[model samples]
Target: MFYWILKYLVVGPVLKAIFRPWIVGAKNVPKTGAAILASNHLSVMDSIFLPLMIERPMSFLAKSEYFTGKGPKGWATKWFMKGTGQIPIDRSGGSASEAALNTALQVIGRGDLLGIYPEGTRSPDGRLYKGRTGIARMALVAKVPVIPVVMVDTDTMLPIGSSRPRLVRVGMVLGEPLDFSRYEGFEDDRFVLRSVTDEIMVALQRMGGQAYVDDYASKFRKQAEESGAAPTSAFS
Candidate 1:
């Protein structure tokens, strides 16, 4: 419906013509059935461009704020997000986090592609950050393979806090599907989840060609904000 119209008739054509985005190892994506596309978040455009490049639509768990806002810009943002089939969830942890995870499970239950940024937020720097274990937990609970995807140079095209985008090329690299069936019943164990997450991150680092940062991206953003220093990013 609206999603297809936007993809085929409008946004998709325009973006592809401009950026000429390309993908490698696209065959790794399952043509049918549920799977997780675990990606490194470098820019907000990562969510937008990934779906347009892939033949299948991917449902991303976006922040609740994208769905709730005021005025014209807010209205446009909400509609665009909905039209793209993104789900809005609170990321403030606690019960809200559990609810978000449940929503993701529901998407997986429907045998759909669920896109997740394991870093929890976009990288403040080009370096990949330690992944959040939620993606690992969902993959284990859903009994699906996790496909590592690396989005290249999207930050340069449309960096965070930038209102205007540069007409630059973008590319995506898909790594072989990772099966964690061996750790099937160990999803409840925090250590196991961390192990699974780390394994996925390692694959992403190799494919993305970015330095690995042991700290969380959110932590770096927080520190930058506290110090009133501009954050570093590949976009620069």
Candidate 2:
């Protein structure tokens, strides 16, 4: 299929040669079955590079905006995202978001790896922000392992609002799988969900070594924009 051809034959080879991505603890990921690869969102390329490095195809839940653009560029973008195994979904909160959650659960139910960014959005700065409980919700509901992944220097290689890659080596660290079976039957509990989310974030902080901020990345960006400050920096 297109995913394998692009991963093994086309784009993957070119990217590996250029970036020379160094992956540590690759063995931590299971060869098969359902699992959630929980990672911090650094740049847009996080979604691209993670799948290329892994042997199995990773289905990421992407915002619908990526699939709903205009003109030739939009067409290209949509296909590119599709080819990369991304599933487009409405990110808007409330009832509309249920569809995305259903899609994610379906992917996991099919025994496929589902990648998710707990922060919900890329960091305005390099700091690791508080995670969303949605990841925990999915993991607990699906009863799958949550593997924490860290993308080192990815933001530097391809920062936000930058059209070109910097051609620098990137590093990734895959932490051991986190098991939350003790919290089983408590997925609907908001307190338990936040606790699980924080535990995953702590693992990411340890592996990524980024400063931990208790606020969400989206909230931070909104605050910056409200203050009339530019919120486009790769790192603060």
Candidate 3:
């Protein structure tokens, strides 16, 4: 109910009317079934804007801090994330990751689109960083296609720490879905996981027209932010 109200009555009309985001290969998104809308991270608005454009009730995994915040701000924040179907993911360590993976698998188990940022964090620079193997493991475990996505030019609207957002052209491209059926049985193998992850990055490179990096999001954080604020993230 909140999602619709925000979509139709508030943010949706304002975003669509102002940004006029161009969506390419939108049909690439499946009408049903479990699939991952994997993409490169670019801006803070990536989370809110991507969900607004998709036709289905897609959900995303957000950092746990958003839910466990302090003060009246924290309470309001938690309520909003819950109302919109965003799950808090613990990104601390192995145990946390496992828990997050289980949560993600559960969502996939129910046949829904899972929005994930392959880069883990938005690029401090615009370059596409190496994708995490979590996306690959999810694909293999869930046995679903991973649709590569690229969001262009959102850093301008809501760059980090800026109280006001700029009105500019934004774009999201949904590329052809990637399938790894040939290596179905080796989904748990680490090397196979890396191989599949690299494959996803390659597709993102094609769509983003940026050089690819084979490191974690932290490695690129400083570079991605030399200009202030990364230009990427999860669809929701």
Q: List the residue pairs that clash in candidate 3.
A: 41-232, 41-233, 42-231, 42-232, 42-233, 43-231, 43-232, 124-224, 124-225, 125-224
Residue pairs in candidate 1 whose N, alpha carbon or C atoms collide under 3 angstroms: none
lDDT of 3 by residue, 1-236 (tens): 88787777876898899888888888999999989989788776777777878888777888887788788878877877776668889878699989989999999999998999988876765678888899899899889999998998887676654545688888899999999888898978999999999999998898789887778877666665565445332221
User: Candidate 2: which stretches are off by over 4 Å?
Assistant: 226-228, 231-236
Cα lDDT for residue 41, candidate 1:
88
Per-residue CA lDDT of candidate 1, range 126-226, in tens?
78999999999999999999999999998888765576778989999999999999997998999999999999999999887899999899999888767
**Backbone clashes in model 2, listed as residue pairs:** none
lDDT of 2 by residue, 1-236 (tens): 99888889988999998889888888989998999999998887888889988888889998888888789878887888899999998878987667777899999999999999999988978899999999999999999999999998888887755667898898889999999999999999999999999999999999989999998899887787677664564222
**Which has the higher TM-score value, candidate number 1 or candidate number 3?**
1
| lDDT ranking, high to low | 1, 2, 3
lDDT of 1: 0.89
Model 3 misplacement above 4 A: 222-236
Cα lDDT, model 1, residue 130: 95
Q: How high a TM-score does candidate 1 get? A: 0.96
Measured by lDDT, the strongest candidate is: 1
Candidate numbers sorted by TM-score from highest down: 1, 2, 3
Residue-level lDDT for 228 in candidate 2 = 61
